[model samples]
Target chain A: MTVVTDGQERAGDVRLGRVGRGVRVAVALVGIGLLINGSVRASDDAWPFGPMSQYAMSVPDDASITYTRISAQTDAGTTVDVPLNIEGAGVARAEIEARTGEIVKDPSLLQQVADGWAKKHPDKPKYVKLELIRDTTQLVKGRVVGPPTPAVLATWEVRR
Target chain B: MSARTVATRAANWFTPAIAFARIAWLRTVLYLFVIVDMHAFVRDTRLKGEHPGLYQPLLLARMFDLPKPTVFNTTALYVVLIAACLVGASNYFPRIAGWIVAPAFTWWVLIGMSDGKVDHDHLALVIALWVLPTVKAGRRGRASYNDQARSESAGWVIRCVQICVIATYFLSAIAKLRSAGWALTWPGSAVLTWAIVRRPHPVGEWLLHHPWMLHVMQWVGITAEFLSPVILWLKGRWQLFGALFFLGFHAANTAILLIHFLPTVVCWLAFAPMERIVPWFQRRRASDSDAGEAEDQAEHGREAKEQAGA
Candidate 1:
């Protein structure tokens, strides 16, 4: 009876020891994992959870991106490339088609863009590049070199 | 211990001011760096381009058609506030610095919030800074980078900072869970496919043309993000695994995506118990810490002797 009791006690101790080792190993693994997880997710790059890619992801397809050139009326009309953002890809395609076609179909738009550019800069005439970053909105940038102050504009449809 | 005794002990030792300063210092530096970068980009880009309108810093503004200066002015105000906060972070003049910085930072962020893109990251920083001004960080200099003097709030301040740091992962995990498609599509493959279809980098575009690579990448991304939270919260070998997963994921993102903010992401590793990072640092620095400390103590002892002789 005494021998049997000693054997049983030894078995119980062994089981407890194994369980303790397993728990320790599991704990160590968890701590290491947490450190790693925190490091990668909290970076400051890619605009650090701001816009850039996020906005780019949201932009819809079928937006127009066009490129055009405008002529300044003041100081002997000089031709320059200008960019504009129209509503849709179809509008951009239509404008391009109209430019190549016999009659100037969208005279009103061309004149409006030209007038807007002319008003923004009084000192020198220049050209602008407008790209559609999103639907219904255009990004316009320009540079004017010397007199004759010509404005050339171009546009392109945004892609999603 | 009894709850009453515990409360009394805590009250006797607790130093709110020092705790506030430590977190304030950490946040102010981080916020300042981000704002400075934004300011530099805006200032430089505006000069080269005709309309300052081309660069929309955040998309929330565009959705509502908010005024142009709405974005610019708000960002500029943060830039100024961050500068003030940095001074506050230095542990100089707590009452004045704390009062001014807390409101200034909050107001600047409020303007950013007025638009749609109220980033959760900025929200975390605001809370950290706001709570700090109420603490005694200014008086004790416990939070100052150069000050080694332990303050009354040091332990509790550290504990709170640790909690805040840990919460970031918790929130990110919740966000991932909310975006169910991430798990369903698998982030690795989905992100790869998305990148390829949209603005494909040279390497990503090449890989996309091969469907096998795209499929593999997709699985990797999903597994990393989804399982990461488990490892992060556990804080041992698990934390190491989590870090490795993040490093791999971020490296892949950096390689493929034109997005440029990985450095700040890696800094979050500071929250890991120093026990783990210490061994790694020890190999590089060897006896540096002991030698430096010994030198400082020796210098202090000499100063004391000179005073005695005088």
Candidate 2:
């Protein structure tokens, strides 16, 4: 009977030891998590934000962005403001494909063009306003390479 | 049974209390009160001026979709979610509130995530919605401490939510290491300056121009996140200081950014034991075990009286 009691006592000690080990493991994991967190906190462009940086930089999906307004000084010299749904960022590098004066129906492809410029000048402006006129679409087909300039705007005939 | 058996049973009974303390420390203090509230401020500050009308629902909808929502079709869904949140805050039919509010909030977050610029605040709401359904916040478990049984079994979900909150900091800290510039500039006025130039609060704007203020904020932010484990776990004056620092941080954020979630703020009130404030409120209210025994004895005494009368 004493032998059986002694074995039981040893088994209980082992179980207690295992429980202690588990708690230690938990504390250690939490510590590692905190250290990692502290290091990552030091970075500027963090995760959730980094993943969506492109989209935030992308033009507003809906036809109209609240803060930005699109006003066109028409050929008649009359300025009419119609909100162009500004989807992406970088005003200088953005290109718009217009079909006979109206913006293109599919804006998804614009993202690809914007992304290409973003790769070259990651920090510089990528927002380019494209005024699509009937004949102008052919003149500026691929990526617009640099920032929006008087020469580029004049070449594209983007008056507004 | 021997005295050892009796002592063991008593110790076993105290397990839940220890667990409760752990949960309260993490859930109420760090995640719910500090980290989550800070994210709310970030989102709120971002959506200012002309952006409120368009951004509020748009951001919420984007939470539902990480990129590209199917369509921003459901206005009714938001209203229901708001209503459920209001009710859940009141702790009425907590289980039901948890179920409805969690899904509705999740739906809104899915919509918010659809946009690339997702606010971290929605993650907190998601975790809260998931856990609120299982907690014994309402009267459901008021009859006995066995209510912990129902809660302990749902441990996986609780841990997941905890993990999510912890990861936000972990990931953020890791990002800090990637660039030397972030270390030198971070925990400084640049964050505040960016806010001031864009959307300046009276106090924030005033403080931004003060070169010393930015330095103070930067150090505080770094030190706070770095010492989070210690500040949150050590119970006493240190815990209170931690809570206050957290409050000040979020309050500053709110002043600068207009996001408001009063429920979350109230939940933080759990940090300081309300027992002292109300004095005898919880005790006078009586523990479930006491109430249960009282009811049982009352029933027995009434039965005896009835039999004697008969």
Choose the strongest candidate by lDDT. 1
Report how closely model 2 matches the true complex, as a DockQ value.
Answer: 0.06
Q: Alpha carbon lDDT of residue B7, candidate 2? A: 47
RMSD of 2: 15.1
lDDT of 1 by residue, B59-112 (tens): 333444544444465555555666665666455665466676655554443333
| Residue A130, model 2, lDDT | 32
**Candidate 1 stretches greater than 4 Å from native:** A1-160, B1-28, B34-79, B94-99, B106-123, B138-143, B146-183, B230-241, B244-248, B261-310
Cα-based lDDT for every prediction: 0.38, 0.37
Docking class of 1: incorrect
Q: Report the backbone clash tally of model 1.
A: 75
